[model samples]
Target: MNRRHFLMGLAATMATARLSFASTGLIAPINIPLWKGPPPGGGGPEGRVIQSHSGALRNITVPGLSILLPSSPIGHGVLIAAGGGYKQIQDGKEALPAARWLIARGYTAYILHYRLPGEGWHDGNQVALQDAQRALRIIRQREKQVSVLGFSAGGHLLGMAATRPDYRAYTPQDAIDELPASADRTALIYPIITLEKPYTHTSTHRILVGPHATASEEAAWSVQHYVSSQTPPCFIVQAKDDPRSDPHNSLIMYDACQKHGVPVEMHRYPTGGHGFGMGKTGTETVEWPGEYKKWLQQSNAGG
Candidate 1:
Protein backbone atom coordinates (compact mmCIF):
# COMPACT_ATOMS: atom_id res chain seq x y z
CA MET A 1 0.00 0.00 0.00
CA ASN A 2 1.07 3.58 -0.57
CA ARG A 3 2.06 5.62 2.51
CA ARG A 4 -1.13 7.70 2.43
CA HIS A 5 -3.32 4.61 2.48
CA PHE A 6 -1.19 2.90 5.09
CA LEU A 7 -1.31 5.98 7.29
CA MET A 8 -5.07 6.20 6.84
CA GLY A 9 -5.47 2.61 7.96
CA LEU A 10 -3.04 3.13 10.82
CA ALA A 11 -5.02 6.17 12.00
CA ALA A 12 -8.22 4.13 12.01
CA THR A 13 -6.56 1.35 14.00
CA MET A 14 -5.15 3.83 16.50
CA ALA A 15 -8.49 5.55 17.07
CA THR A 16 -9.94 2.50 18.78
CA ALA A 17 -6.85 2.05 20.94
CA ARG A 18 -6.03 5.68 21.61
CA LEU A 19 -5.01 6.57 25.13
CA SER A 20 -6.75 9.48 26.82
CA PHE A 21 -4.32 12.06 28.07
CA ALA A 22 -7.33 14.00 29.34
CA SER A 23 -8.09 11.27 31.84
CA THR A 24 -4.67 11.86 33.34
CA GLY A 25 -5.07 15.65 33.20
CA LEU A 26 -2.27 16.18 30.71
CA ILE A 27 -2.48 19.24 28.47
CA ALA A 28 -3.40 18.68 24.83
CA PRO A 29 -0.65 19.57 22.39
CA ILE A 30 -0.68 23.16 21.07
CA ASN A 31 0.41 23.74 17.49
CA ILE A 32 3.06 26.44 16.98
CA PRO A 33 4.18 27.52 13.53
CA LEU A 34 7.92 27.46 12.93
CA TRP A 35 8.01 30.99 11.61
CA LYS A 36 6.53 34.26 12.83
CA GLY A 37 5.53 35.33 9.31
CA PRO A 38 6.54 33.82 5.99
CA PRO A 39 9.17 31.10 6.18
CA PRO A 40 12.66 32.03 5.06
CA GLY A 41 13.39 32.19 1.30
CA GLY A 42 9.67 32.93 0.86
CA GLY A 43 7.47 29.80 0.59
CA GLY A 44 5.51 31.47 -2.20
CA PRO A 45 1.75 31.34 -1.63
CA GLU A 46 0.48 28.94 1.03
CA GLY A 47 -0.39 25.54 -0.44
CA ARG A 48 -3.40 23.46 0.40
CA VAL A 49 -3.11 21.48 3.61
CA ILE A 50 -3.81 17.96 2.43
CA GLN A 51 -5.23 15.30 4.73
CA SER A 52 -5.69 11.56 4.64
CA HIS A 53 -9.09 9.83 4.70
CA SER A 54 -8.64 9.37 8.43
CA GLY A 55 -8.04 13.12 8.89
CA ALA A 56 -4.31 13.13 9.43
CA LEU A 57 -2.49 16.11 7.90
CA ARG A 58 -0.34 15.02 4.97
CA ASN A 59 1.13 17.49 2.51
CA ILE A 60 2.02 20.74 4.24
CA THR A 61 3.39 24.11 3.14
CA VAL A 62 3.53 25.90 6.47
CA PRO A 63 5.44 23.73 8.92
CA GLY A 64 4.60 23.74 12.64
CA LEU A 65 5.72 22.33 15.99
CA SER A 66 3.70 21.00 18.93
CA ILE A 67 4.75 20.13 22.44
CA LEU A 68 3.15 17.24 24.35
CA LEU A 69 3.76 17.96 27.98
CA PRO A 70 3.90 15.11 30.46
CA SER A 71 1.52 14.83 33.42
CA SER A 72 4.53 15.13 35.70
CA PRO A 73 7.54 16.98 34.36
CA ILE A 74 10.90 15.23 34.52
CA GLY A 75 12.94 18.15 33.19
CA HIS A 76 13.88 16.11 30.11
CA GLY A 77 12.55 16.67 26.62
CA VAL A 78 12.56 14.88 23.26
CA LEU A 79 11.95 16.22 19.77
CA ILE A 80 10.50 13.66 17.35
CA ALA A 81 10.74 13.78 13.54
CA ALA A 82 8.71 11.20 11.60
CA GLY A 83 9.92 10.01 8.22
CA GLY A 84 8.25 9.84 4.79
CA GLY A 85 11.30 9.83 2.50
CA TYR A 86 11.17 13.69 2.38
CA LYS A 87 7.92 13.47 0.39
CA GLN A 88 5.43 13.00 3.24
CA ILE A 89 5.28 12.93 7.03
CA GLN A 90 4.28 9.66 8.70
CA ASP A 91 3.08 10.99 12.06
CA GLY A 92 0.68 8.11 12.74
CA LYS A 93 3.31 5.42 12.26
CA GLU A 94 6.18 7.26 13.88
CA ALA A 95 5.49 10.56 15.64
CA LEU A 96 2.38 10.07 17.77
CA PRO A 97 3.28 6.71 19.25
CA ALA A 98 6.78 7.86 20.13
CA ALA A 99 5.57 11.12 21.58
CA ARG A 100 2.90 9.39 23.66
CA TRP A 101 5.45 6.90 24.93
CA LEU A 102 7.85 9.64 25.91
CA ILE A 103 5.19 11.72 27.62
CA ALA A 104 3.98 8.72 29.59
CA ARG A 105 7.52 8.38 30.87
CA GLY A 106 7.52 11.99 32.14
CA TYR A 107 9.49 13.61 29.29
CA THR A 108 8.14 16.58 27.37
CA ALA A 109 7.61 15.52 23.74
CA TYR A 110 7.82 17.81 20.73
CA ILE A 111 6.29 16.70 17.42
CA LEU A 112 7.54 18.40 14.27
CA HIS A 113 5.40 18.83 11.17
CA TYR A 114 8.34 19.50 8.90
CA ARG A 115 7.99 20.73 5.32
CA LEU A 116 8.58 18.34 2.43
CA PRO A 117 11.18 19.22 -0.16
CA GLY A 118 9.20 17.64 -3.00
CA GLU A 119 6.35 20.08 -2.48
CA GLY A 120 8.32 22.99 -3.96
CA TRP A 121 8.70 24.67 -0.61
CA HIS A 122 11.20 27.50 -0.17
CA ASP A 123 14.81 26.38 -0.28
CA GLY A 124 13.43 23.00 -1.35
CA ASN A 125 16.28 20.86 -0.14
CA GLN A 126 16.68 22.74 3.13
CA VAL A 127 13.11 23.24 4.31
CA ALA A 128 12.94 20.16 6.54
CA LEU A 129 16.33 20.79 8.14
CA GLN A 130 15.43 24.39 8.73
CA ASP A 131 12.25 23.42 10.50
CA ALA A 132 14.06 20.78 12.53
CA GLN A 133 16.68 23.26 13.70
CA ARG A 134 14.08 25.87 14.51
CA ALA A 135 12.14 23.38 16.61
CA LEU A 136 15.29 22.46 18.53
CA ARG A 137 16.09 26.07 19.23
CA ILE A 138 12.57 26.85 20.37
CA ILE A 139 12.52 23.90 22.75
CA ARG A 140 16.00 24.74 24.02
CA GLN A 141 14.91 28.20 25.11
CA ARG A 142 12.62 26.59 27.69
CA GLU A 143 14.16 23.19 28.29
CA LYS A 144 17.84 22.43 28.84
CA GLN A 145 17.69 18.62 28.91
CA VAL A 146 16.68 17.77 25.38
CA SER A 147 17.19 14.77 23.09
CA VAL A 148 16.04 13.80 19.62
CA LEU A 149 14.39 10.70 18.14
CA GLY A 150 13.89 10.14 14.44
CA PHE A 151 12.79 7.38 12.06
CA SER A 152 14.16 6.68 8.56
CA ALA A 153 14.71 9.93 6.66
CA GLY A 154 13.90 11.81 9.85
CA GLY A 155 16.80 9.92 11.38
CA HIS A 156 19.03 11.29 8.67
CA LEU A 157 17.94 14.79 9.63
CA LEU A 158 18.48 14.11 13.33
CA GLY A 159 21.87 12.57 12.64
CA MET A 160 22.86 15.64 10.68
CA ALA A 161 21.71 17.94 13.49
CA ALA A 162 23.60 15.92 16.08
CA THR A 163 26.85 15.65 14.12
CA ARG A 164 26.88 19.03 12.45
CA PRO A 165 25.28 21.36 14.97
CA ASP A 166 26.87 24.38 13.33
CA TYR A 167 25.57 23.68 9.82
CA ARG A 168 22.77 26.11 9.00
CA ALA A 169 20.21 25.58 6.28
CA TYR A 170 19.66 29.33 6.14
CA THR A 171 21.18 32.45 7.65
CA PRO A 172 20.12 33.19 11.22
CA GLN A 173 17.40 35.76 11.65
CA ASP A 174 17.21 36.24 15.42
CA ALA A 175 17.98 34.98 18.93
CA ILE A 176 16.66 31.44 18.36
CA ASP A 177 19.62 30.75 16.11
CA GLU A 178 21.93 31.58 18.99
CA LEU A 179 20.82 28.45 20.84
CA PRO A 180 22.72 25.24 20.14
CA ALA A 181 21.15 22.66 17.84
CA SER A 182 22.84 19.78 19.63
CA ALA A 183 20.87 17.03 21.34
CA ASP A 184 22.08 15.45 24.56
CA ARG A 185 21.09 12.03 23.22
CA THR A 186 19.71 10.72 19.97
CA ALA A 187 17.71 7.65 18.90
CA LEU A 188 17.77 6.60 15.23
CA ILE A 189 15.31 3.95 14.04
CA TYR A 190 16.11 2.20 10.80
CA PRO A 191 17.71 5.46 9.66
CA ILE A 192 18.90 6.46 6.20
CA ILE A 193 22.31 7.60 7.38
CA THR A 194 24.09 7.90 4.06
CA LEU A 195 23.27 9.57 0.77
CA GLU A 196 25.73 7.34 -1.08
CA LYS A 197 24.81 4.94 -3.88
CA PRO A 198 23.38 1.42 -3.32
CA TYR A 199 22.34 2.25 0.29
CA THR A 200 20.59 5.63 -0.07
CA HIS A 201 16.83 5.67 -0.46
CA THR A 202 16.38 6.98 -4.02
CA SER A 203 13.38 9.21 -3.42
CA THR A 204 14.90 10.78 -0.33
CA HIS A 205 18.21 11.30 -2.10
CA ARG A 206 16.44 12.91 -5.02
CA ILE A 207 14.40 15.26 -2.82
CA LEU A 208 17.27 16.17 -0.52
CA VAL A 209 20.10 16.61 -3.01
CA GLY A 210 18.09 16.94 -6.23
CA PRO A 211 18.61 14.97 -9.46
CA HIS A 212 21.69 16.97 -10.55
CA ALA A 213 23.41 17.18 -7.17
CA THR A 214 27.18 17.59 -7.20
CA ALA A 215 29.59 15.16 -5.55
CA SER A 216 30.35 17.69 -2.79
CA GLU A 217 26.67 18.16 -1.94
CA GLU A 218 26.12 14.41 -1.63
CA ALA A 219 29.27 14.00 0.48
CA ALA A 220 28.23 16.84 2.78
CA TRP A 221 24.90 15.12 3.53
CA SER A 222 26.26 11.66 4.26
CA VAL A 223 26.16 11.76 8.08
CA GLN A 224 28.82 9.10 8.54
CA HIS A 225 31.53 11.45 7.30
CA TYR A 226 30.56 14.14 9.85
CA VAL A 227 30.61 12.06 13.00
CA SER A 228 32.99 13.49 15.58
CA SER A 229 33.62 13.44 19.35
CA GLN A 230 31.04 16.21 19.67
CA THR A 231 28.37 14.02 18.10
CA PRO A 232 25.87 13.13 20.80
CA PRO A 233 25.62 9.63 22.23
CA CYS A 234 23.20 7.69 20.06
CA PHE A 235 20.97 4.62 20.36
CA ILE A 236 20.36 2.99 16.98
CA VAL A 237 17.72 0.34 16.24
CA GLN A 238 17.46 -1.47 12.93
CA ALA A 239 16.44 -4.82 11.46
CA LYS A 240 18.93 -6.97 9.63
CA ASP A 241 16.10 -7.99 7.33
CA ASP A 242 14.80 -4.51 6.55
CA PRO A 243 14.23 -4.52 2.80
CA ARG A 244 13.74 -0.77 2.31
CA SER A 245 16.83 0.61 4.05
CA ASP A 246 20.11 -1.25 4.29
CA PRO A 247 21.08 -2.31 7.83
CA HIS A 248 24.61 -1.25 6.93
CA ASN A 249 23.42 2.34 7.21
CA SER A 250 23.26 1.90 10.96
CA LEU A 251 26.49 -0.13 10.93
CA ILE A 252 28.51 2.63 9.29
CA MET A 253 27.06 5.18 11.70
CA TYR A 254 27.93 2.98 14.65
CA ASP A 255 31.44 2.49 13.29
CA ALA A 256 31.89 6.22 12.80
CA CYS A 257 30.65 6.98 16.31
CA GLN A 258 33.05 4.40 17.73
CA LYS A 259 35.97 5.71 15.72
CA HIS A 260 35.27 9.25 16.86
CA GLY A 261 34.93 8.30 20.55
CA VAL A 262 31.21 9.10 20.60
CA PRO A 263 29.22 6.73 22.80
CA VAL A 264 26.76 4.66 20.78
CA GLU A 265 24.60 1.55 21.11
CA MET A 266 22.97 -0.48 18.34
CA HIS A 267 20.31 -3.20 18.15
CA ARG A 268 19.87 -5.26 14.99
CA TYR A 269 16.81 -7.42 15.19
CA PRO A 270 16.61 -10.55 13.07
CA THR A 271 13.53 -9.59 11.02
CA GLY A 272 11.44 -6.59 11.97
CA GLY A 273 11.63 -4.92 8.55
CA HIS A 274 11.72 -1.09 8.12
CA GLY A 275 9.61 1.67 9.70
CA PHE A 276 8.74 -0.30 12.79
CA GLY A 277 8.53 2.68 15.11
CA MET A 278 7.14 1.05 18.23
CA GLY A 279 7.57 -2.30 16.50
CA LYS A 280 5.07 -5.18 16.61
CA THR A 281 3.91 -6.45 19.95
CA GLY A 282 5.24 -9.86 21.08
CA THR A 283 8.29 -9.42 18.83
CA GLU A 284 11.93 -8.94 19.79
CA THR A 285 12.00 -5.53 18.16
CA VAL A 286 9.28 -4.32 20.51
CA GLU A 287 11.92 -4.21 23.23
CA TRP A 288 13.68 -1.29 21.54
CA PRO A 289 11.90 1.36 23.54
CA GLY A 290 12.95 -0.23 26.81
CA GLU A 291 16.49 -0.66 25.54
CA TYR A 292 16.61 3.01 24.54
CA LYS A 293 15.44 4.10 28.00
CA LYS A 294 18.19 2.05 29.61
CA TRP A 295 20.76 3.53 27.30
CA LEU A 296 19.58 7.04 28.11
CA GLN A 297 19.92 6.42 31.83
CA GLN A 298 23.40 4.99 31.41
CA SER A 299 24.52 7.87 29.23
CA ASN A 300 23.14 10.46 31.58
CA ALA A 301 24.78 8.84 34.59
CA GLY A 302 28.16 8.60 32.91
CA GLY A 303 28.06 12.17 31.72
Candidate 2:
Protein backbone atom coordinates (compact mmCIF):
# COMPACT_ATOMS: atom_id res chain seq x y z
CA MET A 1 0.00 0.00 0.00
CA ASN A 2 1.05 3.57 -0.62
CA ARG A 3 1.63 6.03 2.21
CA ARG A 4 -1.88 7.50 2.28
CA HIS A 5 -3.41 4.07 1.88
CA PHE A 6 -1.24 2.65 4.60
CA LEU A 7 -2.13 5.51 6.92
CA MET A 8 -5.80 5.05 6.12
CA GLY A 9 -5.52 1.34 6.78
CA LEU A 10 -4.21 2.18 10.23
CA ALA A 11 -6.90 4.81 10.71
CA ALA A 12 -9.69 2.39 9.70
CA THR A 13 -8.78 0.24 12.67
CA MET A 14 -9.43 3.24 14.94
CA ALA A 15 -13.14 2.98 14.23
CA THR A 16 -13.24 -0.53 15.64
CA ALA A 17 -11.37 0.11 18.90
CA ARG A 18 -14.52 -0.53 21.04
CA LEU A 19 -13.83 1.91 23.84
CA SER A 20 -16.44 1.60 26.55
CA PHE A 21 -14.76 4.35 28.50
CA ALA A 22 -17.72 4.75 30.85
CA SER A 23 -16.28 1.87 32.85
CA THR A 24 -13.00 3.67 33.36
CA GLY A 25 -14.25 4.88 36.76
CA LEU A 26 -13.76 8.56 36.02
CA ILE A 27 -16.38 11.27 36.00
CA ALA A 28 -17.13 13.16 32.82
CA PRO A 29 -14.36 15.47 31.69
CA ILE A 30 -14.66 19.15 30.82
CA ASN A 31 -13.53 20.14 27.37
CA ILE A 32 -11.52 23.36 26.95
CA PRO A 33 -10.41 25.15 23.83
CA LEU A 34 -6.65 25.37 23.67
CA TRP A 35 -6.74 28.81 22.20
CA LYS A 36 -8.83 31.60 23.64
CA GLY A 37 -8.81 33.67 20.46
CA PRO A 38 -7.85 32.69 16.92
CA PRO A 39 -5.12 30.09 17.00
CA PRO A 40 -1.88 31.66 15.77
CA GLY A 41 -2.04 30.19 12.23
CA GLY A 42 -5.63 31.34 11.49
CA GLY A 43 -7.17 28.10 10.20
CA GLY A 44 -10.69 28.95 11.37
CA PRO A 45 -12.56 30.84 14.10
CA GLU A 46 -10.79 31.56 17.36
CA GLY A 47 -11.62 28.89 19.91
CA ARG A 48 -14.00 27.11 17.59
CA VAL A 49 -14.79 23.69 18.96
CA ILE A 50 -15.45 21.05 16.31
CA GLN A 51 -17.50 18.08 17.26
CA SER A 52 -15.43 15.05 16.40
CA HIS A 53 -16.98 12.38 14.17
CA SER A 54 -17.85 9.11 15.85
CA GLY A 55 -15.80 7.11 13.36
CA ALA A 56 -12.10 7.85 12.92
CA LEU A 57 -10.59 11.29 13.68
CA ARG A 58 -9.16 13.54 10.96
CA ASN A 59 -9.26 17.07 9.59
CA ILE A 60 -8.92 18.72 12.94
CA THR A 61 -10.67 22.11 12.80
CA VAL A 62 -10.56 22.73 16.52
CA PRO A 63 -7.79 21.87 18.96
CA GLY A 64 -8.87 21.37 22.54
CA LEU A 65 -8.42 19.28 25.66
CA SER A 66 -10.82 16.84 27.28
CA ILE A 67 -9.95 17.42 30.93
CA LEU A 68 -10.39 14.39 33.16
CA LEU A 69 -10.12 15.01 36.89
CA PRO A 70 -9.63 12.18 39.34
CA SER A 71 -11.71 11.91 42.52
CA SER A 72 -8.60 11.25 44.53
CA PRO A 73 -6.13 14.10 44.04
CA ILE A 74 -2.54 13.40 43.12
CA GLY A 75 -1.78 17.16 42.87
CA HIS A 76 -0.40 16.60 39.44
CA GLY A 77 -1.63 16.38 35.82
CA VAL A 78 -0.56 14.80 32.56
CA LEU A 79 -1.03 15.93 28.97
CA ILE A 80 -1.43 12.99 26.62
CA ALA A 81 -0.60 13.19 22.92
CA ALA A 82 -1.92 10.17 21.01
CA GLY A 83 -0.13 9.07 17.86
CA GLY A 84 -1.69 8.67 14.43
CA GLY A 85 1.41 9.11 12.30
CA TYR A 86 0.26 12.77 12.15
CA LYS A 87 -2.71 11.58 10.07
CA GLN A 88 -5.16 10.96 12.90
CA ILE A 89 -5.23 11.25 16.72
CA GLN A 90 -6.13 7.57 17.51
CA ASP A 91 -8.23 8.89 20.38
CA GLY A 92 -10.24 5.74 20.90
CA LYS A 93 -7.50 3.18 21.17
CA GLU A 94 -4.33 4.93 22.24
CA ALA A 95 -5.15 8.36 23.68
CA LEU A 96 -8.30 7.62 25.66
CA PRO A 97 -6.97 4.41 27.15
CA ALA A 98 -3.96 6.36 28.34
CA ALA A 99 -6.08 9.17 29.77
CA ARG A 100 -8.30 6.65 31.56
CA TRP A 101 -5.28 4.90 32.99
CA LEU A 102 -3.90 8.17 34.31
CA ILE A 103 -7.24 9.25 35.72
CA ALA A 104 -7.63 5.99 37.58
CA ARG A 105 -4.24 6.57 39.09
CA GLY A 106 -5.23 10.00 40.50
CA TYR A 107 -3.85 12.09 37.68
CA THR A 108 -5.74 15.02 36.25
CA ALA A 109 -5.38 14.13 32.60
CA TYR A 110 -5.67 16.37 29.55
CA ILE A 111 -6.25 14.52 26.30
CA LEU A 112 -4.95 16.72 23.49
CA HIS A 113 -6.85 16.77 20.21
CA TYR A 114 -4.32 18.53 18.04
CA ARG A 115 -4.22 19.61 14.41
CA LEU A 116 -2.94 17.27 11.70
CA PRO A 117 0.12 18.65 9.96
CA GLY A 118 -0.98 17.68 6.45
CA GLU A 119 -4.30 19.47 6.73
CA GLY A 120 -3.34 22.85 5.23
CA TRP A 121 -2.20 24.60 8.35
CA HIS A 122 0.33 27.35 7.72
CA ASP A 123 3.74 26.07 8.82
CA GLY A 124 1.96 22.75 9.22
CA ASN A 125 4.79 20.78 10.77
CA GLN A 126 4.73 23.10 13.78
CA VAL A 127 0.94 23.09 14.14
CA ALA A 128 0.68 20.13 16.51
CA LEU A 129 3.50 21.51 18.59
CA GLN A 130 1.57 24.73 19.01
CA ASP A 131 -1.48 22.95 20.32
CA ALA A 132 0.64 20.88 22.70
CA GLN A 133 2.32 23.97 24.08
CA ARG A 134 -1.00 25.70 24.55
CA ALA A 135 -2.46 22.68 26.33
CA LEU A 136 0.52 22.41 28.63
CA ARG A 137 0.22 26.08 29.45
CA ILE A 138 -3.45 25.65 30.28
CA ILE A 139 -2.71 22.72 32.57
CA ARG A 140 0.02 24.77 34.16
CA GLN A 141 -2.52 27.47 34.91
CA ARG A 142 -4.23 25.05 37.29
CA GLU A 143 -1.00 23.95 38.95
CA LYS A 144 2.76 24.04 38.62
CA GLN A 145 3.02 20.24 38.28
CA VAL A 146 2.29 18.47 35.01
CA SER A 147 3.86 15.71 32.97
CA VAL A 148 3.59 14.59 29.36
CA LEU A 149 3.11 11.14 27.81
CA GLY A 150 3.11 10.52 24.11
CA PHE A 151 2.64 7.43 21.93
CA SER A 152 3.95 7.04 18.39
CA ALA A 153 3.88 10.29 16.39
CA GLY A 154 2.63 12.16 19.43
CA GLY A 155 5.91 11.22 21.00
CA HIS A 156 7.65 12.94 18.15
CA LEU A 157 5.60 16.08 18.77
CA LEU A 158 6.25 16.01 22.52
CA GLY A 159 9.90 15.36 21.87
CA MET A 160 10.07 18.66 20.05
CA ALA A 161 7.93 20.44 22.62
CA ALA A 162 9.89 19.08 25.57
CA THR A 163 13.24 19.97 24.05
CA ARG A 164 12.49 23.10 22.05
CA PRO A 165 9.72 24.48 24.18
CA ASP A 166 10.95 27.94 23.35
CA TYR A 167 11.06 27.46 19.57
CA ARG A 168 8.09 29.85 19.18
CA ALA A 169 6.24 27.71 16.61
CA TYR A 170 3.66 30.48 16.26
CA THR A 171 3.02 33.99 17.59
CA PRO A 172 1.84 33.90 21.14
CA GLN A 173 -1.72 35.27 21.31
CA ASP A 174 -2.33 35.35 25.04
CA ALA A 175 -0.82 35.42 28.51
CA ILE A 176 -1.12 31.66 28.73
CA ASP A 177 1.76 31.31 26.29
CA GLU A 178 3.89 33.06 28.89
CA LEU A 179 3.93 29.80 30.85
CA PRO A 180 6.81 27.53 30.03
CA ALA A 181 5.93 24.48 27.93
CA SER A 182 8.36 22.22 29.72
CA ALA A 183 7.14 18.96 31.28
CA ASP A 184 8.12 17.89 34.76
CA ARG A 185 8.28 14.33 33.47
CA THR A 186 8.13 12.80 30.02
CA ALA A 187 7.15 9.34 28.72
CA LEU A 188 7.37 8.12 25.16
CA ILE A 189 5.88 4.78 24.05
CA TYR A 190 6.55 3.11 20.73
CA PRO A 191 7.40 6.54 19.34
CA ILE A 192 8.72 7.76 16.03
CA ILE A 193 11.89 9.42 17.35
CA THR A 194 13.63 10.39 14.15
CA LEU A 195 12.48 12.17 11.03
CA GLU A 196 15.54 10.97 9.15
CA LYS A 197 16.72 7.87 7.31
CA PRO A 198 17.37 4.19 8.15
CA TYR A 199 14.99 3.99 11.11
CA THR A 200 12.35 6.64 10.36
CA HIS A 201 8.74 5.69 9.68
CA THR A 202 8.52 7.04 6.11
CA SER A 203 4.85 8.02 6.19
CA THR A 204 5.20 9.91 9.46
CA HIS A 205 8.34 11.59 8.25
CA ARG A 206 6.46 12.75 5.17
CA ILE A 207 3.33 13.79 7.00
CA LEU A 208 5.21 15.92 9.50
CA VAL A 209 8.11 17.28 7.45
CA GLY A 210 7.06 16.55 3.86
CA PRO A 211 8.47 13.99 1.41
CA HIS A 212 11.19 16.36 0.20
CA ALA A 213 12.26 17.87 3.52
CA THR A 214 15.90 18.94 3.48
CA ALA A 215 18.58 17.15 5.44
CA SER A 216 18.96 20.12 7.75
CA GLU A 217 15.19 20.28 8.26
CA GLU A 218 15.03 16.60 9.12
CA ALA A 219 17.94 16.96 11.50
CA ALA A 220 16.25 19.92 13.15
CA TRP A 221 13.06 17.88 13.61
CA SER A 222 14.81 14.84 15.01
CA VAL A 223 14.20 14.67 18.77
CA GLN A 224 17.52 13.10 19.72
CA HIS A 225 19.49 16.05 18.41
CA TYR A 226 17.74 18.52 20.72
CA VAL A 227 18.19 16.76 24.05
CA SER A 228 19.87 18.83 26.78
CA SER A 229 20.53 18.62 30.50
CA GLN A 230 17.56 20.90 31.14
CA THR A 231 15.19 18.45 29.45
CA PRO A 232 12.81 16.57 31.73
CA PRO A 233 13.40 13.10 33.12
CA CYS A 234 12.16 10.70 30.48
CA PHE A 235 10.78 7.16 30.41
CA ILE A 236 10.67 5.24 27.14
CA VAL A 237 9.08 1.86 26.28
CA GLN A 238 8.88 -0.03 23.04
CA ALA A 239 8.86 -3.60 21.89
CA LYS A 240 12.03 -4.53 20.03
CA ASP A 241 9.82 -6.63 17.76
CA ASP A 242 7.68 -3.65 16.77
CA PRO A 243 7.00 -3.85 13.06
CA ARG A 244 6.02 -0.21 12.51
CA SER A 245 8.29 1.87 14.79
CA ASP A 246 11.84 0.58 15.07
CA PRO A 247 13.52 -0.28 18.37
CA HIS A 248 16.28 2.17 17.46
CA ASN A 249 13.86 4.97 18.33
CA SER A 250 13.86 4.19 22.05
CA LEU A 251 17.59 3.70 22.06
CA ILE A 252 18.19 6.93 20.19
CA MET A 253 16.25 8.96 22.73
CA TYR A 254 17.89 7.18 25.65
CA ASP A 255 21.35 7.82 24.21
CA ALA A 256 20.52 11.48 23.67
CA CYS A 257 19.41 11.82 27.26
CA GLN A 258 22.52 10.04 28.52
CA LYS A 259 24.79 12.22 26.45
CA HIS A 260 23.13 15.33 27.81
CA GLY A 261 23.05 14.17 31.44
CA VAL A 262 19.24 13.99 31.43
CA PRO A 263 17.92 11.13 33.56
CA VAL A 264 16.28 8.52 31.34
CA GLU A 265 15.24 4.84 31.35
CA MET A 266 14.03 2.54 28.60
CA HIS A 267 12.21 -0.79 28.46
CA ARG A 268 12.46 -3.02 25.42
CA TYR A 269 10.11 -5.96 25.30
CA PRO A 270 10.80 -9.13 23.34
CA THR A 271 7.35 -9.31 21.78
CA GLY A 272 4.24 -7.12 21.25
CA GLY A 273 4.75 -5.54 17.85
CA HIS A 274 3.09 -2.09 17.82
CA GLY A 275 0.02 0.05 18.63
CA PHE A 276 -0.66 -2.02 21.72
CA GLY A 277 -2.58 0.60 23.67
CA MET A 278 -2.57 -0.10 27.40
CA GLY A 279 -0.66 -3.12 26.21
CA LYS A 280 -1.98 -5.90 24.02
CA THR A 281 -3.75 -8.55 26.02
CA GLY A 282 -1.72 -11.73 26.61
CA THR A 283 1.50 -9.97 25.66
CA GLU A 284 4.49 -9.04 27.80
CA THR A 285 3.96 -5.37 26.89
CA VAL A 286 0.98 -5.42 29.23
CA GLU A 287 3.40 -4.77 32.05
CA TRP A 288 4.40 -1.34 30.71
CA PRO A 289 1.51 0.60 32.19
CA GLY A 290 2.21 -0.69 35.68
CA GLU A 291 5.88 -0.01 35.27
CA TYR A 292 5.19 3.53 34.11
CA LYS A 293 2.99 4.17 37.12
CA LYS A 294 5.70 2.88 39.43
CA TRP A 295 8.21 5.15 37.77
CA LEU A 296 5.92 8.14 38.04
CA GLN A 297 5.31 7.44 41.73
CA GLN A 298 9.00 7.07 42.38
CA SER A 299 9.72 10.30 40.56
CA ASN A 300 7.13 11.97 42.76
CA ALA A 301 8.67 10.44 45.87
CA GLY A 302 12.16 11.48 44.93
CA GLY A 303 11.23 15.13 44.58
Each model's C-alpha lDDT?
0.77, 0.78
Can you tell me which runs of candidate 2 are displaced by over 4 Å? Answer: 1-26, 44-55
- State every prediction's TM-score relative to the real structure: 0.87, 0.88
**Deviating ranges (above 4 Å) for candidate 1:** 1-27, 44-48, 53-56, 299-302
Task: List model 1 lDDT by residue over 270-293, tens digit each.
Answer: 988888888876567998999988
Ten contiguous residues with the weakest lDDT in model 2: 11-20
- Residue 239 local lDDT, model 2: 93
Q: Tell how far residue 297 is off in model 2, in angstroms.
A: 0.6
- 11-97: candidate 2 lDDT, tens digit per residue: 332222213234444555676667654456654222222224532367566567878888786888899998878887877778778
lDDT of 2 at 254: 95
Relative to the true structure, candidate 1 has a C-alpha RMSD (angstroms) of 6.4
